[model samples]
Target: MPYVSMSALLAFVLVYGLGLGPIPFFIASEMFEVAPRPAGMAWGSLANWGGNFLVGMGFPTMRNVIGPYSFLLFSAFTMGLFLFTKFYFPETRGKTPTQVAQLCSRGLRSRPLTTATAKHIL
Candidate 1:
C-alpha cells in the first residue's frame, strides 16, 4: 500500500514537473506573435493562478460535501482538460503563429494542410 501510494505520488509529481508546471509559462507566448505575446501570457497566467485559487478555496468544501467521492470530481476535471487539450490544442512546436491560428480556427478537430495550403499559410 505504501509503495503504491508513493509510486503514484512520484508519477504525478514527475508529470506535473515535466509537463504541466512549465508549459503554461511558454505556451501563450508561442500562441501569439510579438504584438500580443505579452498580453496573451499575462491573461494565461491570470487564468492559471485564478484556477489554482478556485481549486484551493473550493476543495475543502467540495470534499466535505462529496466525501471520498471528492477525488472523483477532480478526476473528472482532469479528464475534461485532457480531452480538451487533445482535441482542441494544436501541435504548435513547429507551426508558425499564422499556421497555428489557422489550424485552431477550424474548430473541434483539426486537419493537416496540403502542400498548397501549407505553403499559402506558412
Candidate 2:
C-alpha cells in the first residue's frame, strides 16, 4: 500500500477513539438495572479489554498467517455485530430497565414502538 493509504488506514483508530470509543460504555451503563449495574459494568469492561488484548496480541500473528484476509475476518465480525444490534438491541434512551429487558427478550421480532405502547410501558 502507498504511504497515504497506510496513513489513512492507521488514522481510523484516532477517529474511533475520539468519536466512538465511549459508546459501548454508555450503552452498557444504560442496559443494566441500578442494583446490578456496577457488576455488569465491571464484567462488560473486562470483556471489552479481553477482546482488545486478543486483537492487539494476536493481530500480527493473524496477519502473518492469513495475510490480507485478516481484515476480512474483522469486517465480517463487524457486519455480523451490526446486524445483530439492528435486529435485537432495543432503544434504551428514556426507557426503564424493565422495558429494555422486555424489548430484548422479545428479540428482533418486536414491532416499532408506538406512542401508546411507550406511554403504557412508561
Candidate 3:
C-alpha cells in the first residue's frame, strides 16, 4: 500500500509537471486575439483554479459515495479531456493568436497548422 501510494504520487507529479500543469494558462493566452486576450486569460485562470477547487473539495465526498469507483470516474474525465485536447483545442504552436482564433472559429475539424501558414503566437 505504501509503494502504491508512492507510485501514484510520482505519477501525478510526472504527469502534471510534464503536461497538465501550466497548460490552461498557456492555452488561455494563446487562444484569443490580442484585443480580447487579457480578458480571456483572466477568465481562463479563474475557471482553471475553480475547477481545481471543485475537484479537490468534492473528491472526498465523491469517494465516500462511489468508493473505489471514484478512480474510474476520474479516468473517464481524464480521457474526455485528452480527447478534447486532441480533437478540438486549436494548435497554438507556431501560429498567431488571431490564426488560432480563426481556426477555432472554423470548429472542431480545422486544418493542421503548418510552418508555411504559421506565425509567432506570442
C-alpha local distance difference test of each model: 0.77, 0.75, 0.80
Per-residue lDDT for 21 in model 1? Answer: 60
* Candidate 2: Cα lDDT at 116: 81
Overall local distance difference test of candidate 1: 0.77
Local accuracy of candidate 3 as per-residue lDDT tens digits, 11-113? 9879877877777778778877889888988887888789889989999999999998898988899888876686567667888767898987777774466
* lDDT for each residue of candidate 1 in 1-122, tens digit (9 for 90 to 100): 99999999899879877876666677687777778778988988888788778988998999889998998988898888865675468788788888876765675574565697567645
Q: What C-alpha lDDT, on a 0 to 100 scale, does residue 40 get in candidate 3?
A: 85
Q: How high is each candidate's TM-score?
A: 0.66, 0.67, 0.68
lDDT of 2 by residue, 1-122 (tens): 69989899679878767754556677678777778778878887777788779989999999999998898998898778765665457778888887776665665573576798667656
Predicted model with the maximum TM-score: 3
- Root-mean-square deviation of every model: 7.5, 7.0, 7.3
Candidate that beats the other on TM-score, 1 or 3, i.e. the better one: 3
Residue pairs clashing in model 1 are none
Clashes of each: 0, 0, 0
Cα error, residue 84 of model 1, in Å, equals: 1.2
Q: Which ten residues in a row have the lowest lDDT in candidate 1?
A: 104-113
Give the Å error, residue 76, model 1. Answer: 0.9
